[model samples]
Structures are given as structure tokens and as C-alpha cells.
Target: MTTAYYTHADCKRHEMGSWHPESPERLQAIEDQLIASRINTLLDYREAPAALESDLARVHTADAIYRIRENCPSERSEYDHFPLDADTSLNAYTWRASLRAAGAAVAATDAVIDAEIENAFCAIRPPGHHATSKEAMGFCMFNNVAVAAKHALEVRGLQRVAIVDFDVHHGNGTEEIFNGDQRVLMVSFFQHPYYPYSGTEHPASNMVNVPVPAHSYGNVIRELVSERWLPALEAFKPEMIFISAGFDAHREDDMGQLGLVEADYAWITQQIMRVAKTHSHGRIVSCLEGGYNLSALARSVTAHVKILADLE
Candidate 1:
């Protein structure tokens, strides 16, 4: 089976702002590298479908959902109103793009569960994981990975799912959505005392929140995964694995102070795949989260995807 690649043009339309770091160029950079490396030919490509309201409702509250939609301005052409938070905003295309972002994860999950592909990578935007059950923050409108994890459990009849987030910022939102759910095991690390600044506090038992120091190198992250994440993940033995694949932790990206590179991303993907092979029958659905620097983000993502597609 081939690895499935999912994305859509709408994702590019959900522009935060020209000055914003999470620009549509991020997607273009990845696609360009995939083509340049000829890795695009090794995978199956599909347009991401819009996420159904019912699937979104499983993870996000009705109030949060309604607010995002109600806040979406219909009259705007080039730009839209600032949103509930300063960092995130709603353009005319944000609503549609957010749905597709969440939907891509759902579609990826479906493809993996159905054995249509060995694995899947969703190249979506309006990066989720920062948006909470109650509000959106940190350049996010919807919690995409959380929605997919919920779908795997509630819709697909899966008992356990693991979320692996290597984003530079803490996925406070994902942790909030799956706080009390024992069936979901989340192992992640982020730069501490940074934006949203909440991972250090008391987290839920099911959540393995590792707060790494600023400017840490790949060795530090590798140690965390081997010493901490692997044990928790192995014990969980999830039926499926989901990844919040963020590449901003790269040393070249000004978004965070972490000292990771493209090789680091591939290393983590390999580690996650090993766990999937042992327990989850090699089922994995990964979606984009952060990673702002265009060139570094592209290289890092291609590295992660190469490993996911076994082209590495």
C-alpha cells in the first residue's frame, strides 16, 4: 500500500495575514520540495474533504463552533476582522479551510483504518492543536488532531489512540480536549515558558507533557522520546496513532528556540512508525500543525514525509 497525501487549494485561501508567520507559502514550500525530491511520485495524492459538523462536534463544543462560524465575515474580500484572539483571525476562507483542516485528519484516519493506504500525511493549514474546546488561540481555529482522535474512538470503534505532538509550542488545546479520556494517550514536548505558557502546570494523568528548555538540541529531544514517550506509548498500545507534525522546532526557524533539523524530524517519524508496527498494525494519520520558516519547514516536512512514505 502507498502512503496517502491529502491537501486542498482552500487551505491556501485561509490567510491569517501577509505579515503572519503561518502563511500559505508554508504549504507551497513543502509541495515544492516534495516535487524537487521526486518523492511526490512515490505517494497517493488526494484533495482534502471538508469536515462534517457531526465529526467536529465530537471534540469541539457547540458554543465554540458557533462562535467561529458567527465570527466569519461574509463581506470581506482581501482581509477580515481580527478574531477572539489577536494572534488568530477569521477571513472569508478561514471557515472553509478550518473545516477541511479538521476533515483532512478524519479522511486520513478513514484511509488508514480501511487499509486503503499504509499511512497518510495531511498537508493542511490554519494549524490546529492550539485551539481549545472553548476558544481558538495561537493561530488556530479548530483542533484538527483532537477531532480525528475522537473520531477514531467514537466513530471507528477504536479503543485506544495515541497523539504524538512534537511542535515547538505546547498543544494545550489537544490536552484540554482529551484531558480525562484514558483511551487517548498523548506524548508531546514544547519550549517551556513560551507562548500560551501552560504545559508546565498540573496536566492530566493521560497526558505526557514534556516541557523542554529553549535552545535544546536534537539529542535532548531524542532522550525524551526514548526515556519517556516510548514507555508510555508502549504501555498504551493504541489501535491507531496520530501525529501533530510541527517543524518550527528547527534551529533555523525563529518561531522557537529549539535546535532541531530535518534529520530530527525523520528520526521521530521512524520512532513513531516502530511503535505503530508493534501495536497498531502500522496505522498512522499525521496532520500539519506549526512550522513557520518556509525553507526549513519545507525541508523538515519532506524529511518527515519521506520517512512516512518509506522513501528515506
Candidate 2:
């Protein structure tokens, strides 16, 4: 499989702070691991282009887009930060980086649909899935996967798509954006009683929000995917699959209390690939979301991408 690895240098410059867990070093670490594992040479590497304003308009309101664009601290010092929320901050490079992050997803979607590649993995940040249509929060500036899903449906003329989120925290933004939209089916399992918790209560029918408890191990996750996510995905028979790829649930990651390891990630990705192969013509686009512990995040991503690239 010709898997494209999409990323950009601008994505590495959108720093919140030196102490933030979602640092640019996270991308660097993933790259290091991919190189160390000898997986980098097997895939196609592409620079992420800036997303057009029209692309942003598909999923974000004009006001919301204006707010983010106007809030860039371009003329300020390197240390200056414009806070979007308590956790999310915009540095001078954030605007450009946000465009690049979202753009990577859009470009990857187009590339996959055009059959230029079998699948893709976007190593981008500030991690999305937390940013909503109306607001940016939780260290996220834009809903990258949501934007790409919209692109596939609205721009590319696809009728249906599925989003699989394995992040430790709920993808409140993604759920909200496509809540009542019939064209997309979202399946996710997050730590209940966790940060930005909103997936459990009466989500729309299109959303399969399975809330697992903290300290839940990989087996619990695997079982839920088989029993819950798989059924919905098979029933939906999506034309494409989008993944909010997050590694924060790793046992070694302090971002959340979950016992997932690299093997678990590989298995989950394999399952997604199976579904994609059966229904979506092996078309999948995955975007980075959250992962704190650098070592764990790097290893887990390497494992996940190995499966995406069919290296295993």
C-alpha cells in the first residue's frame, strides 16, 4: 500500500508554551520513531499545503474563521501568546500552522479519493477533535478531521463517510459538527468523566459514543470495537473512513488513565483497515489528535502507521 505521510514545518511552529504537553516536539518524536523503525522510507512524504478559506468555511462559521485569523499574535514577541482558552493559545505562527494542519487532512482526503495513495497519516498539531465549529479549545485551533470529512462529502461528492476516534478524551467538536448530519457516522470510545466530557448523554443516532472508564485496558477497548463500533460501521458502509488518531490512552501517557499499549494501537488500526478494505475501497485518512508522553506517543504512532502502510 502506498501510504502518504502528510506534515509541514509550520505545524511544528505552532507552540502553545514551552511547558505544554502538545508541543511541536511531539511531531519530531513521531518522525524520529518512524525513522528509527525504518518506516519512513517505505511511505510517501508530502508537505501540507495551507487550507483555503473556502475549505475552512465548509466546517467553520465565517465569524469563527474571522476570530481565529484576527487573533494571530503575528507582530508580538516570540513569547507572546493569544489564549483561545485556558489551554489553547495562538502564537505568531499558529494561524499558518492551523491552516497547514487542517490543510494536511484536506489534501490527504483528495489524494486518497483520487487513488494517488491507498491511505495517509497526518502528523499534525495543535491537535484537533477538541475544537468545535463555534470555538477553539483544549489545545486545538481547528477541527482538522471534521474539515476533511466535510470536504469528502461536500466537495468531492461522496455520499457517506465514517469517523473513528480512539482518543482518550471525547471528540466533542467532531460530534457537534456532524451531530445531526446523516452523511457521516462517528464511532468513538473515550475515558468517561474525563476532560471535555459530552459524548455519553443522548448523542445523535449517527454517533456511536462509547464511554469507557479510566484504567480500562486494551481488551476492553478491543471488545467494544468488535461489538459496538464494527456493527455501526458495517451497517453504515461508508464511502470513506476518517480517523482522529490519538495515542494519549497509552498506559505510559499521563494525559489520561488508560492501559493501551503499542500492540493495542496496532490491533485497532488493523481493524479499521479491515473495515476500510471491505467497504471504503481501502480509503482512509488519519489525523493526529492527542498524545503526551513523547516515548509512548512516538511508539504508538509508529505501530499505528506501520499498520496503515501495511508494513506488518
Candidate 3:
């Protein structure tokens, strides 16, 4: 089995600020670990192509797209920022970076569905799980995985796709976009009462949202995945699997209080792989979501990708 790695140099150019946890260095850190672990050369590497407007339209509203583009600074020297929310902002390169990130998802999906690779992982940033159809929130500009999931079904003709979001925060945007769509099933675990604070309420039937309390541990996630994620994934029998892989739940990342470690990330990845092996014929596409601390993020991502690439 081979894993395809997708990323872009523009992804490193879109910086929110000096203080933002979701910085360009996050991607660099992930790459550093991949090289250190000797996993970088073990798979196919590709520059992520920019996603087409048509693909993005599958999950985002035209108004939102217009507003996002309109908000982009004309040039790097033209402006410092245009805040989307208190957390998200538009720098000069944000628009292109967002497009590349979304495009990376689409590219990964195509590669996997076309059987060119066993699976794929997108290291592009500006995480998407928090972006809703109409608004950008929580450091996300476009719903990357949602666009890919839609592309898988609408363009690639896949009947069913499963999205597994294990970010420390709920994938509220993904749930909202694919809420009642029978073609997709989104399973996730996030800390309750967290940022954007809305997943604990009434969720759609297709959404399997398990809320974790603050200070929880990886064991909690393991039990939940075994009891909640696997059965639903098996029953749905998805033709393709997409993971909203986030490492913020790690013990070393101060982004959340989940207390998970690299081992936990690898464990969950293995479980997801097994499910894909059974139902999706090993077709999987994982996109980076949240991981703050450089060291922990790198280690956690290396662990996750090692299993995905069969380098473990």
C-alpha cells in the first residue's frame, strides 16, 4: 500500500499572526518529523492543486465565497489583516492558501478513488472543520473535507462517504453542511463547551457527535471509537473514508485539555485504517485540522502517517 502526501508552499505563506497557534510552522513541523522518521520518501509526494470554484460550491454558499475573496488584502503591503472572526483573519495570501488547502483535499480524493494510491494525507492548513456554509469560524476559511466528500459523491460517483473528525473541537461546520445527507456519515469527538461552543445541542441523525469533557484522556476516545465510530462506519459501508485528523487533543498541545499522546493518535489512525480496509477497500483521505505545539504536533502526525503509509 502507498500513501500520497499533498501540500503546497503557499500554505506556509498564509500566516494569521505572530501569536496565532495555527501558524505556518505547524506544517513545517509535520514535515520535519516525517523526514526524521524516514517516512517522507516512502510515498508519493505532490503539490496540491488549487480546488475549482465548482467543487467548493458543493458545500459552501456563493455569498460566503464572495465575502471571503472580497476580504482578501490586495497585496502583502496593502494591509495587515481583515478579521473573519476574532480568530480567523485574511492576509494577502490567505485566499490562495485557502484555495490550495481545499484543492489538496480534492487532489487527495481523486488520487485515492482513481486507485493511484492506497490512501492520501493533506498537510495543507487553514483547517476547515469549523467553517460553515456561510461563515468562516475558528481559524477555518473553507470546509475542505466537505468539499472533497461532495466531490467524491457528485463528481467521482461514489455512493457513500464517511467523515471521521477526531479534532478536539467539534466539526460543527461539517455537521451543518452534510447534516441530513444520506450519502455521508460524520463521526467525531470534541471537548464540550469548547470554542465555537455548539456541538452539544441537537445534532442531525447522520451526525454521530460524541462530546468529551475537559481534562479527558485518550482512553475515553478509544472506548468511544470502538463503541460508537466503528459500528456506524461498518453499518454505513462507506465507499470512501475521509478523516479530519487533528492532534490538538494531544497532551503536549495546550490547545485543549484532552490529554492524548502520539500513541493515541496512532491507535485511532490504525482503527480508522482497519475500517477502511474492511468497507472502503483501503480508500482513505486524511486532512490536517488542529495541532498547536510544534514538537507534539510533529510527533503525533508522524505517528498517524506512519500507520497510514505502512511504515510502522
Against the reference, the lDDT scores of all candidates come to 0.91, 0.94, 0.91
Q: What are the per-residue Cα lDDT tens digits for candidate 1 across 234-285? A: 9999899999998999999999999999988999999999999999989999
RMSD of each: 1.0, 0.7, 1.0
Position 2, candidate 2: lDDT: 97
* Candidate 1 pairs with clashing backbones: none
Candidate 2, 1-312: lDDT as tens digits: 899999999998889889999999999999999999998999999999999989988888888888889988865586789887888888989889999999999999999999999999999987889888998989888899999999999899999999999999999999999999999999999999999978988999999999999999999999999999999999999999999999999999999999999999999999999999999999999999999999999999999999999889
Candidate 2 ranges beyond 4 A from true positions: none
Best by TM-score: 2
State TM-scores per candidate: 0.98, 0.99, 0.98
Residue-wise lDDT of candidate 3 within 1-312, one digit each (tens)? 899999999999888889999999999999988899887889799999998888889889999898888888878454488988788999988889999999999999998999999999999889999999999989999999999999999999999999999889999899999989999999999998898687778888788999989999988889999999999998999999999998999988888989899889899999989989998989999999999999999999899999999887
The CA-based lDDT of model 3 is what? 0.91
**TM-score for model 3?**
0.98
